[model samples]
Target chain A: MEKKVILDGNAVAASVKESLKERINLLAQEGITPCLATILVGDDPSSETYVRMKGNACEKLGIISKRIHLPKETTTEELLETITELNEDEKVHGILLQHPVPEQIDERKAFETIAIEKDVDGVTSLGYGQTAFGFGVYPSCTPAAILEIMDFYNIDASGKHAVVVGRSPILGKPVSALLLNRNATVTTCHSYTSNLEQFVKQADIVVAAVGKPNFIQGEWIKEGAVVLDAGYNKGNIGDADYESCAEKASAITPVPGGVGPVTISMLLKHTVISAESYMSKKSATL
Target chain B: MEKKVILDGNAVAASVKESLKERINLLAQEGITPCLATILVGDDPSSETYVRMKGNACEKLGIISKRIHLPKETTTEELLETITELNEDEKVHGILLQHPVPEQIDERKAFETIAIEKDVDGVTSLGYGQTAFGFGVYPSCTPAAILEIMDFYNIDASGKHAVVVGRSPILGKPVSALLLNRNATVTTCHSYTSNLEQFVKQADIVVAAVGKPNFIQGEWIKEGAVVLDAGYNKGNIGDADYESCAEKASAITPVPGGVGPVTISMLLKHTVISAESYMSKKSATL
Candidate 1:
C-alpha cells in the first residue's frame, strides 16, 4: 500500500507562526504592538471558548488581544459604535467580530463598520471583493489557512479542477474565488446543487465546507485527489467521512488537527501584517 | 428535427426599455432627467463608436448623455479627476469609463474612482463584491444583460449546472457570481483549465465569454443545453460556433443581435434605477 501524505495542520500552523516571529520582533523594535480587537456578542459557550482561544494564541505570539464582550441584548447601533472606536484606535491593528451575533443585531452592518485596513478577519464586503479580484490584503482566515496549508505541502492549484461545496460568504465563496484566481478551474456547489456527487467525482481538489459531518462520501472523491476538509462539526468530526476519504485521497487533512489550528494562526499572521503596514505608512509620511 | 428557441436580444432589450420608459417619465414629472456621463480617452475608432452608441441609446430613452473625450496623452490623474467631478455632479446618475483607456492610464484605479452610486456600469470592485454577495444595486452591464435575457425567456437558473468560459473581471467573473446567487451550480473555466470540453459537456447552461471567435465547440455542449454567447468578436462572431451550437442547443442567443443589444439596454436600465434611488433619497430629506 502506498503511503498517503497527511497534511498536518499543527505542523503547517507552526511553520506560519515561526515565520511571523521575526516580523513581530521587527515591529517590537519600532515600539509597535500588533493588536487584534475581538468583539463577541452574547454568551454562547462555544463563542466564548473560541474567543479565549484566539486571545491566547495572540498572547503566545506577543500580539495584543483586546476582547470586547457585549450583552445578549446589544443593539446594532451599539455594536457599530464599538467597531467605530476600534477603527479609530491607533493601537488596534485588526478587528474581528465573531460570527453569529445575536438576532437583533445586524451582523453584516457590523462587519461593514470595520475599517478596510484593519479588517484582518476579511469579513467586510470590500475585503471579499478584493479577495475575488486577487488583491485582498487579508482573506478570511479559514480560506487563507486552506491556501497556506496547500502552499506548505506544495499542492499546486493551477490548472486543477477544484470543487468547493457550500457558498457561505466567508468560507465557500471566497475560497472558490481564491482558487480561481490561482488559475484553477473552480465549481461552486451549494445546497441547491443537484447531482453534487458527480461534480465531486471530477475534482482534482475537493474543499468540503458544507458544515455537515460526513456529508461528502469517499465514493464521491476522485482517485488521488487532494481533500481539504474545512468543516468542524460535533464530536470532532469533519464534513467528510475521514476513514473512507483517506482511503482514496492522495492527501487529507484530519478534522480536529486540520483546518482549525491554522485558521487562528492566519488571524495572528494578518494582525502582524496589518501592524507592519501601519508602521511603514507612518514612517513614509514622516 | 426539434426546433430550437432563439433568445432574441432585440425583443428583450425592447422589453427592458419599455419598462424603463414609465420610470423615466416618473422622474421627468419631478423635473429631473437621468443622466449618464461616458468618458473616452484617445480616439480608438471602435471605442468611439461604442461611446456614441451608448450616448445615442441614452438620448432615445430621454436620459441626458454627457460625453467627455480626452486626448491620447491624458494621464491617470486627469481621468480620475473627470470621474470625480461626474461623481459629485447630482445630474449624472451613472458614469461609464469606456473599456481600454490608453495604455499609460491605470484602468483599475480609474474604475475604482467611479463613485459606487454612480457606477451603473458595475466596473468598480465594490460593485463586483456586492454582486457576488447578491445585493448589488448595479452589476456589470454585460453580466446583467445575460441574466436579463434568461429572465425574459423564462429560463430558471436554479439547480442548473452553468459553465462560464473566460474569467474577465467585468464579464465572466460577475456572471458566474450572478448565476451562483440564483442557486445555479457554477463552474468558472479559463485558459488554464484542462479537459475543458468535459466540464462544458456537463453544463446545463453554457456561457461563452472568451474573446476568441468560435472558441467553444458545438460537440462540447451538453444535449438540450441553453447557450448564452456574451462574446462579440470580429465580424460579429461570438465565442461559440453558432450553427453547430444551435443544432445541439435547446435555446441559444445569436451573436449579432443577442447579448450585444441587451447589454446597452442594461446600462440604460441601471441609469434609470440609480436616478430613481437618487430621487427617493431627495424626497425623503424634503
Candidate 2:
C-alpha cells in the first residue's frame, strides 16, 4: 500500500491565519477589534517563547494583544484579582494565562477563575465540558487543533479503538472525552497504568501526550494506526520515536511541524469567536 | 464456587431511604428540607407512575415534593420556559423531566436547559461531564444507583474490563465514563456496533442497558463475570435473559429487583444534596 502523505503543521496554521484576515477586517469595519490578553508569570524560558509567538500571531491576524507581566513572587490572590479585572474589561475578548504560574499558586483555581465566556484558551472545566459535549464552544487550543487536523484530513474516528496515553486534566482527559464524543472507544492510560504496550497494540488511533520523549516505541504501534504526538521535547523531540515509527506507520505528524503551530492557530481562531460572541451580546442589549 | 446472593431492589431502596431520614431531619433543624421537582406531561401512564413513585419516595424521606403538570400539547419552547422557571425557583432544588417528552418537544434541549447547580438528577450535559470526569456536583441517578449497589455488595470494579452495551447520553455514556473514572477499562457499544459479542465475551463486568429484552445471551457471558442489568422492559423483562445467564454468572442483578429500585433512591439522594447546596449558598450571604 502507498504511504499516506505527511502534513506540515506550520503551513496549515499559516493558511488558517490567512483565512482569518478577512474576518478580522470585517470585524474592524464594524468597529470591533478582537483583543487577546496574555498573562505571563515569572521568566520561564519556554513560556516566554510561547507568549512571544502568540503575540506575534495576534499581530499577524489584526487582533489587539495585551501582555500582563507578573513577577515569580506574585501571590495567588493578586493573580486572581488581575484575572478578575480582565473578566470585567469589555475590550478584552479572551484571556490566556501561561502555564506553570508558580509553585505556591493553585493552578486549578487560577484556571477556574477565568470567566467561562472569556475563556478563549478554553482551560476552564466548564469550557472543556462544553467542548467534550460538542456544544460548539472554544476548546483548549492544542486539543482543538488536533481535532481540526483530523477533520481537515477527513479521518473517520467513529467506532475506532483509541488509546490516549496521558490523563492530564487539560490535555489528555479532554482529548479522550472528545474522541469518545465522536463515537470512538477511548482508553486513557497514565503513569499508573500497567501493561502500556498491551493497550497501544490494540488501538486504531494512538495519541501520546505524556510529555516524555520517545515514550511510545515503534514496535508497539499497530500497522496503519493514525499517530498523533502531542509532545515537544528538547531539540524538537516528540513523545513518539518518530523516525522508526514513520517507516512502519501509515501516517504520523512530525514533532515541530505537527501540533505545535496548530495550537496558536486555534488560539487565534478562538479570539475571533470570542470577539463575535462579545459583539452579539453587546448588540442584543442595544 | 458458591452461588452469589441477589438483593431485592425495593428492599435495598427502602433501606437507603430509611438511612437518609436522619440526615433529612438534621437539615430540617436548619430550616432546610430536601426538595425534588417532578415534571410530567400528557399523563403518559408509565411516566406518571414513575413520577409518583419518586415523589412518594421523597415524602417518605422527609423531603419536599413539588409536581409540575403540563398539557400534552406543550411546545419545546414552553417546556423550556417552564424548566427555566423551576431552575430559578429557590424552593425547587432538583428538577426531573420524565424522559420521552411529548414527541413534538425536543427532549435533549429540555434536559440541557436544567441548571447544573440545580440538576440533582444529573441529566444535563454539564452534570454528565462532571460525572464522567468524577468531579461533578451530581451523577446520573441510574449510574450512581448501579455504583451504589456494587459498593454495597462489595463488588470491586477496579481494573475490570467493563463492557457497556448502550450509548444513550444519560445512562450508558455516563455509566461508562463513571466506570472509566473508577480505573476500569470501559468499552461502550451501541446499536450500530458490529460483532458485539466479541467485546461482551471479553468483559469482566457486563452492563446491559439496551432496552431490548434478551439482547445479551447466556453464552456470550464469561464464566464468572458480574452482571448489572439497567434495562426496564415491558412485562418486567430485562435486557439479559436472567434464567439462562443467572446460572452461569457468578453474580447477577434480577430485573425487577435489581437496578430499578436503586435508581429512585439515587434520585431522592440528589434532591437532598441540591437542597443542602441551596441552603449553604443562602447561608454564605447571611
Candidate 3:
C-alpha cells in the first residue's frame, strides 16, 4: 500500500501567521491597528465558542477583536444598524456577522450592509462577485483558506478537473469560482446533482463541502486525487469519510485540523489587507 | 430522418417585448420612462452598428436609449464622470458601456463606477456578485437572455449536466452561476481545459462561448443535448460547429437568430425591472 499524505491545517495556518506578522507590525508602527468586529445574534453556545476561538486567534496575531452579542429576538433593522455603524467606524478594518443569525433576521440583507472594503470575512454579495470576476479581492474565508493551503502545498490547479460537492454560498460556490479562475475545469455539484459519485470519480481535485457528515463516500475519490474536506460537524465528523477517502487520495486533509484552523487564519489575513487598503485610500485622499 | 429544432432568437425577443407592453404603459402613465444610456468610447463601426440596433430595439419597445459617444482619447476619469452623472440621473434606468473601450482607458475601473441599481446590462462587479449570490439582480444581459430563452423553451436545468465552454466574465462565468442556481450540475471549461471533448460528450446542455470560430467540434455534443452558441465572431462565424452539433442536438440556437436578438431583448427586460423597482423604492420612501 502506498503511503498517503496528510495536509496539516495547523502547520499551514501557523506559516500564514508568520507571513502576516511583518505587515501587522507595519500597521502598528503607523498608529493603525487592524480591528475586526464580530457580531453574534442569539446565544448559540457553539457559535459563541467559535466567536471566542476567533477572538483568541486575533489576540495572538495582534489583530484587535471586538465581539458583540445580540439578543435572540433582534430584528433585521437593528442588525443592519449595527453593521452600518461598523461600516462607518474608521478603527474597524473588518466586519464578521456570525452565521445562523436568529431565524428572524435576514442574514443576506445584514451581510449586504457591510461595506465592500471591510468585508474581510467575504460575506457580502459584492465580495463573491468581485472574486468570481477575478478582481483582487478579499475572498470568503474558508474557500480562500483552501486555496492558500493548496498554494502552500504547491498544488497547481491549472488544467485539473476540480469537483466541488456543495453549493453553500460561502464555501462550495466561491471555491468553484476560485478554482475556475485558476484555470481548473470546475464541476459544481449539490444535493440535486444526479450521479454524484460519477462526478466525484472523474475529478482530479475533490472539495467536499456538503455539510452532512460523511456524505461523500471515500471510494468514489480516484487514486492520486487531492481531497479537501471543509465540513466540521459536531464531534469531528467531516464531509468526506476521511479514513476511506484518505486510502485512495494522494493527499487529504484531516477533519478537525484540516479546514478549521486555516479558515480562522484567513479571516485575520483579509482583515490586515483590508486595514492596509482602507488606511492607504484614506491617506491618499487626504 | 429526425427534424432538428432551431430556437428562434428573433421571435422570442419580439414576444418578450410584447409581454412588456403593459408594464411600459403603466410606467408611461406614471411618467417614469424606462431609459437606457449607451456609452461608446471610440469610432468602432461594428460597435456603432450594435449600439444603433439596440437603440432601434428600444424605440420599438418604448424604452429610451441614450447613446453617448466619447472620443478615442477619452480619459478614464472623464468616463467615470459620465457614469457618475448617469448614476444620479433620475431618468436613466440602465447604463450599458459597449465593451472593448479604447486601449488608454481602464474598462474595469469605468465599470465599477456604474451604480448597482442602474446596472441593467450587469457589467459592474457588484451586479455580477449580487446575481451569483442569488439576489434579485439585474444579470449580465447575454447570460440573462440565455436563461430567458431556456425558460421560454421550458428547458428546465434541474438535475442536468451543463457544460459551459469559455470563462469570459461576461457570458461563460455568469451563465454558469445562473445554471447552478437552477440546480444543474455545471461544469465550467475554458481554453486551459484539457479533454474538452470528453466533458462535452457527457453534458446534457452545452454552452459555447469560446471566441474561436467552430471551436467546439460537432461530434463532441451528445445526442439529444441542448446547444447554446454564444460565440458571434466576425463574418457570421460562431463557436460551435453548428451543422454537425445541430444534427445531434435536440435543440440548438443558430448564430444570427439564436442568442443575439434575445440578448438585446433581455437588456430591455432588465431595464424595465430596474425602472419599476426604483420607482417602488421611491414610492415606499414617500
Candidate 4:
C-alpha cells in the first residue's frame, strides 16, 4: 500500500568502511600501503568539496591520499605527464582525476591516460570493455556501488527487466553491463528514446541517471518495482520524482545521501582492491 | 510485396572493394603496403579455410595477409609473445587472430595482448570500449560490417527502437553501441531475457545474433521492421526464420551471401584503414 523501504546509502557506506579496517592493516603489514593519487585541475567549489570528502574518507580508512592540485591554466600535455608519472608509480594503487577538467585540457584524453591497473574510477574505455566482458578489475564506482546496495537488499536481478535511463560512458552504460552480468534483461535509454514511459512501466527494476531534476515521473514506475535514482540535479533534486515514486515503489533511494555516499565508499573500496591487485601482480612477477 | 529488398551483402562487399582500389594505390605510393598479420593457432580445417579465404580476399584487394600458423600445443604465453611481436612491427598494421584458438590457449589473454593501434579486428576490450563510447578508430568487423550494410540500404536509425538479441562482445554488444551512436534507442536481450517477444514486436529495427537457427519467430516481428540476421548456424541457417520473416519484413539479409561476405570484406577494409592510420601516426610522431 505504501513505500515498503528506503535504501539508506549512508548507512551502507559506513558499514563497508567498518569492514575495511582489517584489510587496510594487512596491506600495511606487507610494507605496501594503499595510496590513491588524486589530480584536481581547477578549484571549482563543488569539485573541491567532493575531493576533500574523498580525502577525508581515505584518512578514516587508514589509506594515504596523495593530492596534486594544479592551476586553471593547466594544459592537456602537462596533465597527461602528471598522469603518466602516477601510472608508473609503484606506490600509487589508484588514480582519480577530478572530472570537468579545465576547458583547454581534453577530459577524455586525460581519463585514458590513467593506466588500466590504477584506473580505480573506471573512467577508461578499456576498463569499461573489461566490465562488459565480465572480468574487469574494478567497475566504475557509482554503478558498482549501486549493485552493492541492491545486493544488501537481497534483490536478485536474474530474469528481471531493468530499464536504465542515461548512457554516459561512466554511469548508465556501465550499470547496464553490470545488470546484464547478473542476468537481468537490460534496456538502455537516452534523450533520443521514444515512448520512454512504455519501457519504464514494463520494467521490474529502474535505474535513473538522466541528470535532470525529477525527469522520471513516479507514476510511470511499475508498482512494487525496485528503483534506484543516481541523479543529483540542482538544489539536491534527483531524476525520479521522489514523492511520486515513494508512493508506489516497493523500494526507493533518496537523493543526496542515497547514491553519493555509496559511490564515494565504493571509490575507497576500489582503491584498496587495486592495492591488493598490484601486490599480487608484483609478487607473481618477482 | 514479399521481401521488397533482399539487402544483398555480397554486391555491397564487391562495390566497397572496388572503391578501395584507388586508395590502396595511393597508400602504395606512400610506401605503406596495407599489411594484415593473420595468426591461426591450430589446424582446424574450417578455421584454416576461413583464414585462407581471408588471405585470398587480401590478395585481390592489393593487401598482403601474412599467415602465421602454430601447433595446437602452443601455450598462452607463446601466443601473447607472437601478438606483441606483431604489435611492435612497423610493417604490420593490423592483427587478426582467427577465433577458437586451441583449447589450451587463453584466447582472451591473447586478444588483450593486442596493441590498441593494431587491433583492427576490434576483438580487444579497448576496441569495444572505444566503440561503446561512440567514436572508435576501428570497430569489430562483423558488427561494423552490419552497419555498412544498413547504410548501403540508406536506413536512418535515428530515434528508432532497435532491439538487439545476444550480448557477445563482437557482434551483438558492439552493434548495439553502434546503433545507439546513430541515435537509435537500443535494448539488448540475451538467454536470460524475459518477454523478449514484447520488445521484438515493438522494435523498428531488430538484429538477431543469438547464434541459434530460427531462434526468432516471424509473427513476433512488427510489420515491416528492418531486420538483420547475423546468425550462421549449422546447415547455413540464421537466427531469424528467414522464410517466415521475408513474408513480413521491409528489408532482410540472407544467411550465406548476406552477412558473411560483408563481414569478410570489412576485415580487409579495416586492415587497409589501419595501415593508413599507422602511417599518419608515425608521420605525426616523426
DockQ of 3: 0.92
Query: Residue by residue across B1-286, what tens digits does model 2's lDDT show?
Result: 9876674677778778887887788788998887888899887999999899988878977888898889999999999999999988888888999887899999888998999888888878767766655687788888888888888887887877788988776788778777877887776777656578877887778999899998898889998888899998999999998987787688888989999999999888888878878878899999
Of all native A–B interface contacts, model 4 reproduces a fraction of 0.85
lDDT by residue for model 1 over A146-209, one digit each (tens)? 9999999999999999999999989999999999999999999999999999999989999999
Alpha-carbon local distance difference test for all models: 0.95, 0.84, 0.91, 0.90
Give the higher-TM-score candidate: 1 or 2.
Answer: 1
Q: Please list the residue runs of candidate 4 whose C-alpha ends up more than 4 Å from where it truly belongs after superposition.
A: A1-3, B1-3
Candidate 2: misplaced stretches above 4 Å? A281-286, B5-11, B103-106, B281-286
| lDDT for position A34 in model 2 | 97
Candidate 2 docking classification: acceptable
Considering only chain A, what is the TM-score of each predicted structure? Answer: 0.99, 0.97, 0.98, 0.97
Candidate 3 chain B has its poorest 10 consecutive residues by lDDT at B1-10
Residue clash pairs of candidate 1 = none
Q: Sort the predicted structures by lDDT, highest score first.
A: 1, 3, 4, 2
Pairs that collide in candidate 2 are: none
What residue runs in model 3 are displaced by over 4 Å at the alpha carbon? A1-3, B1-3
Residue-by-residue lDDT tens digits, candidate 2, A174-213: 7877787788877677775557788888788888899999
Tell me the tens digit of each residue's lDDT in model 4 across A1-286: 7638899998889988887777888888888888889889989998898888898889878889999999999999999999999999999999999998989999999999899989999999999999999999789999998898998888889999999999999899999989988998888889998899998998889999999999999889999998899998889999999999888899989997898899988989999999888878878999
Top model number, TM-score: 1
**Per-candidate interface DockQ score:** 0.92, 0.36, 0.92, 0.84
User: Model 4 has how many clashing residue pairs?
Assistant: 0
